[model samples]
Target: MTSRDTDATTDATTDAAAREHATATTAATGPAATAADAPVTISYEEIDGARIAVVSLNRPAKLNGLTMAMLRGLDDAAATLRRDRDLRGVIFAGAGNSFCAGLDFGSVLKKPMDIVKAFAPNPLAGDGANLFQRVCWEWRRLPAPVIAVVHGHCYGGGVQLALGADFRVTAADARWSVLEAKWGLIPDMSGARTLADHVGAEQARWLTMTGRELSGAEAVEVGLATETTESLDDAHSRARETLRELMGRSPDQLAATKSLFNHAWRSPRATFRAERFEQAKLLLSENAARARTAAMKKTPPNFVRRGTWAFGAKKK
Candidate 1:
């Protein structure tokens, strides 16, 4: 984390088939990952001159379906990114054709212990996040903005995971759905909190209850997608363009901007209070000072990297 040159770290399990097709290269050229690391389900690669973390879900055969291992990997990836001070943006995408098909119900049902372990009550409840919720919430909690690149099938937990991102870009023909209704469940993985942010409460209710599917263009109309394109390549191009634009600005400012809108709906007074407090901190930051100096000189700013700041931390 001290240096952006480090390659994508592997903490997830990968199956043979997935590994054969998936290629992850880091600047450091990490050692060959063990099979213990199977379905090679999650990975992080730096893009756009090491300013963006491209988090990939590598289970292409299963449409990158969620398993207990994949969920844990995502949590680890988030933790790693949380500590990275230099990261300006994040891109979450899936390997193969679909983003993610949803949870692997058959695999999950076979392993009841994994379910129990996932739901086990925490004694301290740090940040009130469990394994399942953390997979989605961690992206929202990051200081940098997260953009999800969606294509093919994005369903159930997949939808929730994308919802956790700051922005979503999808292929025009991609299929999206809140598929939990068919499985006799609700979206317990932070979907309820995030879905409302993108769409109205009524739309969220109908999607969750009926488990209907929507096309990428339809998602944009309904606010589920920030934008849609004719092809997946075009969606990725847009994400890279956004990252390039954001990387030029102060990282702290970007984080503060995300904070403002994320909290706007929950509490108006608190949101206003947060604005003043965040601005005060930003005004005092070394990066902000550099930004101001550069602005006066009519030059591109060379702002300093920001340290990690947790969500809801009280500012001095």
Candidate 2:
């Protein structure tokens, strides 16, 4: 991104909060989205000039697989970001030993139809995207930049979720994969858009079909994870450092610039059009063939693991 104007002296804590207030403007413009309209359980940390929200999958028992509560949390966070007057940017990360393990298999096992329905957007019924998707999309809609820091395991839905951010930082040993194929599903959680931005159609097909895992290092190479840190701690530290640098710049300029770059990629019309084009092909099955086969056979999908674990690796 090009350099922007700012007051130079960054009162980050204050400026970011003010931007949140500006985002709040949407709250009044759009129809009221009551508690009933909320998605799920992701939580947040409101910063002065930005938001450092940690939207955890919260089901650590399920390795933080997604849930309706998590989805509601994502929407609520987006609403807050939307209504906020001073927010300038956002940071999307996760909690626990693993970032997120994707959807909860146990939940699916117990209530397959219900669980699947929850992930569906139901455009005809008014909701067009689910919580897992917004965790990624809302960040893109923000006028300011968003950064995702990944650690531990990020698979299936989780892998696709990170694709939404403007930048990402991943732990060197973090497990990465388009894991949905393992469960006889595809990356339908807004990942198609995010993944395509980084990789070509062919590469995207290969990654999703293989259910291939990637190291944090490999994630950066494939564009799923942006940067690989020696340790998770480093990923946070670097992200914070980058934020400080960004805060030092002008807020309006940064926000406007972010908007411009996003649009340069495509307008709302073009975006959905491309979405249809891609989904049309993927829905036909050239992509998920191998993943489905491997899942049913209960075999480990072909994936090349990278990274070495030495004693006490420093956290990024």
Candidate 3:
């Protein structure tokens, strides 16, 4: 056979495989899977000279149910925000009525290869996080504080996503659940780590095993949510207020505080060392000096942008 003919045959074989995969995926996932085409929206809201990023899950018709594509979009959004030194905070919200209904199994299962890829650990990531874990844990890695404004249904993966944030401001009427138990699965999307920070072992076990739903008020009582508001609007406002309060402080100090708590919690020796190390760094920082001057003058601090820090730094 001629070289050109052989090349054409190879191209035909590749095209046939592509078509087969697409057909199988469509048949398995149905037409609703097309909803994954909607992108997660990332917009910047400038509040008091600080850049606040708002990441809205866009599949409203599905109650912001997570599909493989949506998961990828969320990870990409977090990565983009991580590089922004000027970012003061991030607000995670859902479009339409609900916050998130959790993972859309039908959509994700259709692309079986995607699931395997998401489950595998990323070699370059020091945290040993896979794609699914990164969708939640990446928020914790960001220097800026992250607040999840929850309303409507937040279940399974959705709840895990909220747990990853520094704070969760939930609407009084919102429904929160572990949800994976219903499907005979455990909360594997970094929920095991973050949930422990908020609630005790027994409570976490009960929530995971029973898949019981919690009202926003109950979530706070159990330490799942940072606070509950009368309404979704109130929750958003509360989150903004919290952001403003945090933004008033030195950015480096805030970053240090987050790192200290995240890494040093539950260990006396680690916590003490972290406190001293972070204090040393902050005491010498330009923002710290600005903070001192502003406090003495009773005026707002004009601090410089945040500096780079070693993320997930190990304790000595």
lDDT of 2 at 253: 40
Model 2: per-residue lDDT, tens digit, 27-141? 2111344322222322344443344434333343345566555555666666776555355556666545666667655444466665566666757633377655666677776
Query: How much lDDT does candidate 1 score?
Result: 0.74
Candidate 3 lDDT score relative to the true structure: 0.77
RMSD of 3: 12.8
Ten contiguous residues with the weakest lDDT in model 1: 1-10
What does candidate 1's lDDT look like per residue over 1-316, in tens digits?
0001112232333322223323374221113444233443344444545566667776666777877777777877788888888888887887677787788765676788888888664557665766787788889889998989898888888898999999998999999888888767888887888888789899999988988889999999988899998987788778777877887788888887877776767577888898898888787676677677778999987655784233333432
Model 1: runs farther than 4 Å from truth?
1-24, 27-50, 121-123, 308-316
Give the clashing residue pairs of candidate 3, or none.
none
Per-residue lDDT, model 3, residue 310, is 32
Q: Which sections of candidate 2 miss by over 4 Å?
A: 1-55, 108-132, 264-316
10 residues in a row with least lDDT, candidate 2: 1-10
Residue 159 lDDT in model 1?
Answer: 90
Q: What is the descending lDDT order? A: 3, 1, 2
What ranking emerges by TM-score with the best candidate at the front?
3, 1, 2
Off by over 4 Å in 3: 1-37, 265-269, 308-316
What does candidate 2 score on TM? Answer: 0.64
In candidate 3, position 279 carries an lDDT of 91
